[model samples]
Target: MINQLLLRFKLLKDDKTLIIVMTLMALGLTLVFSSSMSGNYRPEVMLVDSDNTSESREFINELKLSRLLRYTETDEANAIKNIETGMSIGGLVIDQGFSDMMRNGKEINLSILRSKDSIELIQLRSDVQTTAFKFMSKFKTADMTVDIIKGEGFKVVEDELFEETYALSTYYWRYRNPFNLNSQVMDAQKDWAYNPMIHYLIGFTLFFSTFTIVFVGSDILKEKQQKTWQRKLVSPVSNTVIISSLLIVTFIVGMLQVGIIVLIGNYFLDINWGMNIGLMLIVFAAFVYAFTAIGLVVAGLAKTIEQLGAIVPIILVSSAMLGGTMWPLEIIQSKILLTLANLMPHKWAMQIISQTSAYGLNVSNFITSVLVLIAMGTVYLLIGLKLSKRHVY
Candidate 1:
């Protein structure tokens, strides 16, 4: 086994196609990683302060502090134009009497111009409204308290009632104080910190795996049709040597793809691969071997190159959907769909990768994933080998 493995390695070293694939994979990975990590999702916010008061200034300053809102102060017309032209997602307009309205305990009209409904924009609007309301409540409470102390009996009206209600609402909303235990408990969920990266990685990995498998598998069929297999069989190379060499070629190709993604993610995207890269590498290597073995099985079973080509796309698309590549499984409310996703190898690999990347997951879970991949590869390879032995024609 050792000699066969060495000879296979040497054959892979001489394969120019393997070297080219590795180089291309490295380049692609670097680019994708850089693009994702560049902080493109945070939208630009235009602030139009027509009031130019202390309140407006404070609001603008608050918006500036939020990492989500990339604030740019501009005139109302320009802000509206920016939003309409898609240069900015939304614009905040603080009206002329905003500060005076709050001071006089009157309703203030704040205008928000948005091209369309978006969750980020809604969240920003909610935060701004809450801050404004809190400021107004504090101002009203202080003013009314002074009036009451001065023996102004008429000032002890519903305005005073409003102050108490506002205080209570703020306290409850801010701290969840006097906790309402009756709220229904929900099932535990995976943490969302790794959602974006994990989903993207799974999609890319599955796509690549399927493509490599089909491409390499079809090549085997082509060789068989051209009698190239027979020519190799007549040489000093045994059947084991040929099979091992082919497996090594696939393994090298798979690693190259992974390396491309990692390099892109690390250098350009500025994403941390994980705390323990060695463990990640080990897991990834095992996954590559599993995919290669599966490809070999497909090739061994397939009578023609066209048959392999037809099957690859089905595997890629199916695996991607089942693996939570299209969307995060957390948002999928269907319990059945979530349960079914567990059947996919891609899903399991993604779960392990996400947990290790975002959180400091223990080594045991990573090792388990590696072992599972190895077992899968072993099973596929054994089946392929058994089928190959009966290929007398």
Candidate 2:
């Protein structure tokens, strides 16, 4: 066991370049992505064309004028498909008699289908209604003017004159409309003041930390490949010490890597990690332990270091993207993506970081995230131990 510990340390000492590169990658990516965090994200709406008339075309154009939504014109079947598949937050269906309804000055309802209820969907509904009402009123005004002309005994083509009147009204609505409608979405959830530097610093820390931990944990697989594991099993020390030492060494190395990132975050990036030291310590420990166990689990599953190398990166990168490391989950409207995020350890770690971060968070939510990390770590460790039992003589 002592020999095993020394060999691990010797390997760690020799692999200084990998550790340094990982740290640099984390910090560099944080700086690069932090600037783009405020980039615009418009809700996407699938627009179904049922009328397929000039009136419907103009209305679709009106919908596109809104900067709040990115509308895509699709068939009714496709729109409904996108809505059901979670590819779209919602869909809007134009009535079949939309053009006739406009000509007759009758208001028509736009059908809205929501895949899931969200603030964006609510805002989309309002925008659609506003545009529909504007068109409705414009057509009604044209009808009134045509009626007045008929009453005054003017001999003019009714359809042509009404088209001219409606066109003029639409022009006035665009350039000379006095009512400036600025629609804002007020979300149901409580808002927290987000600090970008803190977020990126925390995010990259969690994301890139997996690289070193996984590589270090692969030493167990390396031992099996070199037949060192068998020799250790036959030694005087119990297998318990050998297993405990591997985890303890990996845990210590992970904590050191975190401390290095903290120092760099504080001094190099000028970030204050907030005053939640106790919460930070426990949560960070849970995060590191969970990932360490995950690495060991990867080790237990793989027959050699080469297999571990191939498996670890995909899991780490994909989990990071899903887990709010690349971006916050609050902006994501897909229920499917959100559900998938919960199954990843990266999500729980990031949630804990966000909760205890500089802006502060709800205590109740913070406790829940922390507990989830602990539970995840405990489960992974047990699974790793179970898998390792197959290798033990």
Candidate 3:
């Protein structure tokens, strides 16, 4: 076993294979972080006011106070053009007589254009309706108050009541509205931080790390190509010893790559993998073991390096896609696809990583993921060894 381990290391140390391994790791890390940390999503919108009245200007100003959207003022023609050309995500065209309609208690019409449907546009529309409702509520309250005052046989001036109500509502809105709605930042941390990029990084890291398995498994195909396996089969070294040695070397290499990725993510990208570094490593170790086992199964099934090269990518890529390595499982709306993803070991491993890294969860929170990986590795390794014993090559 020891001789086999040393021999495998010597073979892997060859410049070409070593370069491919290092290059893949470096490329994966770069892409993961670069794509993750690039920028945040902020929806842009154009507000076109055909009225240009004080009421319309005030409405636009109220919208400006929203953190939900970035608003720009533009002419109706330009706003339509922008929405159509996708320069702005959406547009709000406040029609003429907007103020007059509000004063007369008539429904105000608006021409809304959206470049694409999204939650941001939906929220923006809600905000617009909310602002209009609030403004109209002041007028409604003043009218009701005047009616009550006149019913008591006291003379009430309509203009004076409206002005007072508007002023009072504006004052309360700006400074002291006891009943006003507010959103506060909760003291407790969110389960997952709003960083899709970090999820992408971790998911892609797990997905790309499987490539190490494929690369290491290719050693079997290499031995066959060079007729080295024939000599080794007749040697005093037992087949079990040879296979164990290969797995050990591959696991070490795989863990090393995973560690480097974690370190780079921490130091370069400033990602927090959680307080329990040791547990995270354990999860990674189990995942790497399972990934290596998958490679062994692929190697056992393939007859040549060409076959390994062709089929291993299809297998790993499909696993990555189905296993939520390309995106989060939460984003996958299809129940069937999600159920299929659950059957993948990669999905479990990714869940472990996500819980630990993104959610700041303790190791104890997802010991099941670790156990699942171990079980999967055991099953795959058993199948791989059985196929390997056939030795069709």
Candidate 4:
């Protein structure tokens, strides 16, 4: 077994096709990591001051202090126009009676106009609510001080209105932070989801895996057409030995492919792959084996290298679409499509790898995913072997 594995490893080392695959994988990972990790946040806010009261002006002043928010004060009409034209992501409207309502203990109305960007909208809304609460808290505290000195409930109604405003705004803050709060609390790490290195690594890994199958399978077909496969079949090696040798070679080549890409991501792109290196290696091995089995099945069944080459792109594109390579699966709200995503092995593998990298290995999930991958590989290998038996013709 050791001798066979070593021989296969040497075969892969000399294979130009494997070298090209690894090079392409590395290049793809680099490009993806660079693009995805860059921050996408631009806090452009348009403030519409219909009230133009002292309290509203003070509120806008407080908001302007936030480094994340870029404020442009415009009248209600202009603010609406700017938002409609996509000149700003957020538009804050302070109603004409906003200040009077607070002073008179009446409900104050405010409006937020936002573009179609849900993330930016949610973030800006939360920031506005927070600023409003801070301002109201200061105002209430001052009012309480005056009441204590005067020994009367002066502006008690105003304080009541402030409380009402705070209460109403609390609902908007509920979904403000969609990223994992626990992870943030534990590590004080921001940009949890937008980490370019990690996202790119995962996306590229999946993309490369799906694409490489075609090339690898085509190489096998080419070798067969060149009569290299006939030479292997006549050797004293058993069919199991030959197949195992091929799989071992492919697995090692795959690992090297992933390792080089990961190294580039870590050093050049600054992607944190988390602390569990051993677990990552295990997951990578499993994904490679499973995908290689898929390639083997393709190679075994393909009548010609050209046929294998032509079919691989379709399979890869389909897998990428289903596995959330083009976009995160969380964005897909369709229950039926989401349910179908669960059935995709690429999706499962990508999810398992991503979760493992971010949150460390979830023992149960990791084990289950590994088992599934192995099962898939076993099924494909069985089918390939059955087909290979017919190669005697």
Best by lDDT, which number?
Answer: 2
Please provide the root mean square deviation of candidate 1 (C-alpha atoms, Å): 9.3
Model 3 sits at a Cα RMSD from the real structure of 6.3
The CA lDDT at 306 in model 1 is: 72
lDDT of each: 0.67, 0.79, 0.75, 0.68
lDDT of 1 at 173: 45
**Candidate 3's residue-wise lDDT over 1-393, tens digit each?**
677888888877653465356546654665755563345545678988999987788778777876667889988888888889988878988899998997778997887787655445666788778877776776567667777888899876877876687678778876887385766545543333534445666676677778876678657767866778767889898888888888898888888777877777667766666545577788889988997888888888888778887887798889889998765676566899989987788798778777666556665657888898899999999998887764544
Top candidate by TM-score: 3
Number of clashes recorded per candidate = 9, 0, 0, 1
Could you tell me every candidate's TM-score relative to the true structure?
0.58, 0.60, 0.68, 0.67
State the displacement of the C-alpha of residue 118, model 4, in Å, after optimal TM-score superposition: 8.4
List candidate 2 stretches off by more than 4 Å. 1-7, 37-193, 272-274
lDDT of 4 by residue, 156-274 (tens): 56556555554444333343432355533355342323354565567776677555544643455666778877887798877678777777667767777767676666677666565
Model 2, residue 372: distance off in Å is 1.3
lDDT of 2 by residue, 1-393 (tens): 678677668778755787788888888888887655435757679998888998899899889988778899988788889889988889888879988877766668678878676656767978988888887778788889999999999999999998999899989899989367875535523333446677777888888888888788767777777777888889887888888888887887887787788777766776655434456666777888999999888888987667777888898999898998877787687899999999887788777666555455567877787789889989999999887755622
Off by over 4 Å in 3: 15-196, 362-365
RMSD of each: 9.3, 8.8, 6.3, 7.0
Error of 4 at 359 (Å): 4.3
